[model samples]
Target: MEYPDSEAQLPLPTLESKPEAQITKLPTRPRTVFKNQLVDSTKSSGSAGLANKKCRARSLWYALYLPQLSNLDPSQQEKYLNQLAGLMQSVSSTVSFHPQALICEIRSSLKYFAGIDVIHQKLQLLLEEQLQQWGLLDGFLYAASPTVTGSLLLAKSGHNTLVYQKDNLRSALGGLCTDVLDLDKEQRRRLHNMGVRYLRDIWRLPSNGLCKRFGSNFVNQLNKALGKAPEPTCNYIAPPIFITSYELPYELENLDRLLPIADEILAQLCDFLRRRDLSTSHLHFSLLHEKRDHTEIHIGLRQASRSQQHLMLLLETHFNRLTIPAPVIAVRVEVKNFDAFFGHSNSLLETNSLDATHYKDSKLIQFIEELQARLGEDHVKYVSCAAQHCPEHANMQLDYRGSSKPRLKKSSAGSISRNPRPLWLLQDPVRLNINKGRLFHRRVISIISGPERIETHWWSGADVRRDYYVAKELKGSRLWIYREKGGERGWYLHGIFA
Candidate 1:
């Protein structure tokens, strides 16, 4: 009675759940079929099963593409790419460049940078700052994938996707347009005729057919993008030569006035070396004079270094000994020799000891450089050992800047005798007077270590046959005395030991 009946009180059906008779079905058009049909991905013959496998260490690569670089000339493009490569070295040791892209292996760097996400954040910020400094308007696009070609293709297509896993690389690259591939006009036309608009469309075609029509190289390139084949790349190596010049507002003859300019140039060079992780042991400075030949100054370091303070100190030493020949209108600095920089790590336990050692070594080198600059390179010499058996020919003096390095020639026999040798050898061996079997340098001396027989130089006309002994004087001074075997058969004082 309450409602004419519970069934009669039911609500009317909505559009979602309408009665079959009330709903009308619309007629649909037939599906459009292109000339080529999409093949089954599972049956892909060329790179079959590659997308399902995991990427090896060498497979993970990151690519950055700068569209603005294409607008530059080839030389300018190379220079810019080199600069960018140096900057990228901070994140990855292996960096390579393409026509408009920079690619690096990131698998080894992921842990150091925390992860791919962190690396992306850091590189994005770094690149943005660099581009801004360069006055580039259009920003760069980047992609991380399992294959270099895959990452490059994704980046070039303006898709900033990151696919770190191999399993996701193919799918990530599938949607990219076919034009991203390096194709000739004829190849592009053929692809368009085949209705292959995207990479996935090409993948759909039979591999054998694609190989026969497009050639094996093209097919192999696609396979590389899918991690089926390895991609070989030449790493970008910055040129060893670093040259910078500064023009002075006015000509100056005094070296003191010219030093600030040199300092500025050296600062720039050190920054360049730091960015590239390089060091140079030799530097050339030119003092430019208007309408005259420039004065050249050369500075040499005992070891490779990039420290501005050290380099400037050497430069100052050279300037102290130098006299400006003419008024300098400009200054030029050049460095050609480069070496990899290896920074020393400090020890927590032996920090003081290491600091002392480093300080002592640095002071020694500084002293040598200053002496060489003041006394001339030839006058400042270092004694080095040689391979000759004769005592006179056993040691030679070498200049700091000499072309001849202290390298001993390979001896066919085993190493020379381990017997002690004196550091101070006389230019002429003084004939020692032997009285009652006692060797005398200035006073009577007693033999401490014996009579080691040395008979060598027989091959040469001047044969050496002597019995050498270490004798000590009354004052505790050690003398190296040798008794001749032939000729005069006399005793001679050859060397002295400190």
Candidate 2:
């Protein structure tokens, strides 16, 4: 120490040697990655660099504040928030819902949408469309900021401004009244008495004095608004199954009156599914009766879909067959079986090809669905080949509600038969009188084809053994006749072929 120069001999300042009353300066806002751009607070920049930095960070966030939403009751607010959340999910996957506002991180959506301006415009259009649809176009405020807290505060203060840089955040927050700060009544009174009417006045004070005079919470919130601290948020996740109900204004018995309500519900349900890129194969519609009883209708679709018009048409078909037992007070729609939507490309050539195929399939399915809806599901049936060789057991009838795929395999006995089978089969074979060793029905039948033998189900107790023949009636009508091989040797009529 004695050999050191006067400047070097001076004691180095230490944290403990500083006076307790000394005001420690607030830490500078740390460099952050915002909207794919790095912003460093410590770096001094010219006007152009600062302007460029501000532009780069502006796309980081979007805050949506619905002041009217805060006035709604908890349930209504929750429902509105859910609808808003669904709409916001179409804009960005990362959406956080506050009690009074919604914050979306749109940095990841820039590439897909082209740029921040385009995204902003698209979001504004979508939000406006939804608001107009819901009849809530007023008191909706929107802003952009690099930090969630900054954006939220700006939205809360009803400032539809975009804070694009850290420097911009200070000026933006500074313009707001001190009431925007999360301070107690006493603390606010003290601040007001001290002439700190604006956030800028508080910002000008030493951090240590402010903390000592007020509390740490005010300072912490201020830091969060300025992007100097982390702002934790809980993201909103959509429900897997979409179910909603509406109470009718009056008890209704007519199907025509219910159609409009059903249409609206289907529209909302389709919107929910489309936003999540989902389609439902099954939907349940329940009608709450005034007598506290409910009638539930289950709708099954041949193809999963998220189209509101298509769903409403299906519902109308079902409703046509429905007979109300009581006046309905409410209606609920529940969607349980949802699958990811497989959307087709909209190219002209591909759409033409797909449309042709889709039209055919849809037409067939629609016909079957209409038939089942009108006549009962059990009444509409499809015939499928059974795994049996006996003429009576060669095929079975299946419910038409199922997909048209082969359900039974052909038996080895049936598959090996070289003789052609009849298109129609009798429920039970009618005995043909054998007159002088020739088969006799209304007219004597002549054998056009010799016997093709079929024997099956020997392992089971019920066994069959027969020689089948394609016989021609005298009038040129073909008949499928078979004779029992072991018992009675009686000839029987089994089928006919035209």
Candidate 3:
């Protein structure tokens, strides 16, 4: 490659002006693989030169590239990148996103997870697993280096490369084509016309000539990739709320087809919650139908949780009972409510503390959620003690959807007495025919205990004053009977004891 003459005063062409000068064609190359290297902590001569100056410490970064996703829409590509970012955040906090790649700095996380090699293996396994689940595992590449630019460049080369030493940076950059460089149409055409096909060709020319032709920005980018200059990268910030959608390749009408997709999304959702140390009480799923209609399914939990198994179980139960109105072309999952997770710890020895209660309560809540999901929420009901004096009105049925721990009314002066209540109570008292001062239905009934007086609810319109007793019938059945103190003055059957 010949360097342009400094004396030749020609105006550089702006990328916008020469639209047709873009490199529309390029040579195809096979995917390359580079061995992994442990980054050395010792400062190099190049780094030591700037050690006297205030330079940021070199951190190891890995770049992930998905070549197959290049043809996808920008928004779709970004969704995939965001999903990857959420997953990467689990292993490392510092993750940066690009148009076609993700850069993650895992230096600080190395020690906590053993070492870089183990982290690399774990990340690779996780990435492959997630990609397989998403059905996009082919043509995926990644590269690791101590510099962000280097890792990005190597990754863009469509290679699984890992470069640590400064000496190997040139080799990695040399293997890449000019298309990997951040250049527009005019600059790329000029480079190709000057016989600059590979990055190595750019290195052969004089820096001053290249600077004069392409301006200082091109040289700065090159220096950053070579680790001769500092490169600052913005870390990815996860959104406070999670709302992601997945478009199916074909409209799905069956539960089997839709459930796998939902499972994948829920897995990612669980990971997102786990990364933030949070839990969600409700998840709203909107199914986009083929006719442009929306069918919404909401899954609510009795308690906020991040457990994927529990969430999946509830979703499966709901889906089993659901009937899709139309074919769904897409699905969106959103978190309706989220809260910080203050996890519970179980005690080795049983006690009456909140933890023990919480353990039992969690299991009960899960059972209730499963039942409500399978049956309609309205079908399941909880019985709670109400603020009424009468035995028939003392307890009421509550909708299980919003039912928490039953807050039974404390023993108040007007509350029901400590006398034992029957397991079953009739909605209306049935009048009993008494003959010869003995109760009779089909046979003669004998009194098991003496009558207990009861009087209350005088302030309300309905005033009750009665004397109650427990009686035994011919078949060993027990009956609760009460006689009106004033009014019709008849005997009535109120309840039956088990």
lDDT of each: 0.76, 0.74, 0.75
lDDT of 3 by residue, 1-498 (tens): 112112243344332322111111112222121123333343332453344234334466888878877888999888888877877876676788877888988655665676666777777777778878778854467888767888888888877777655667888788789998888899999999999999999989999999999989999999988988877676676655666667676778897777767777788788778877999999998988876668888998878888888998988888887788888877788784788896877667777577778788888888988998888788998787766667777778888765455666465435666776788888898888887988886567787885888788888878889999888778866888898999888988888898
**Ten contiguous residues minimizing lDDT sum, candidate 3:** 18-27
Tens-digit lDDT track for model 1 on 1-498? 111112242243342331111111111212122112232222221263254233223446899999898889999998888888877866776788899899987765665666677787788888888888888863788888878899999999998887756667778888999989999899899999998999988878999999999989899989999989868787865455676566666678788877766777787788778977999888999989988898899888776788898888888888888877678887778788888985666766766776778767766776787777667878987776677677788777877763346566566124555788887898999898877776667788888897988899888887899999998988878989898999999988889987
Worst 10 residues of 1 by lDDT: 18-27
**lDDT by residue (tens digit), candidate 2, 253-343:** 8988888778877877787778678998899999999766789999887667787877788788888888889999878777877888966
Question: What is the Cα-based lDDT of residue 388 in candidate 2?
Answer: 56
List runs of model 3 lying over 4 Å from the truth: 1-239, 344-360, 378-388, 396-420, 431-446
Candidate 1 residue spans exceeding 4 A from truth: 1-242, 271-279, 290-292, 336-389, 393-423, 430-453, 467-484, 487-493
Model 1 error, position 151 (Å)? 25
All candidates: CA RMSD (Å): 23.9, 24.3, 21.6
Model 3 TM: 0.46
The TM-score that candidate 1 achieves is: 0.43
In TM-score terms, which candidate is top?
A: 2
Residue 286 displacement in candidate 2 (angstroms): 1.1
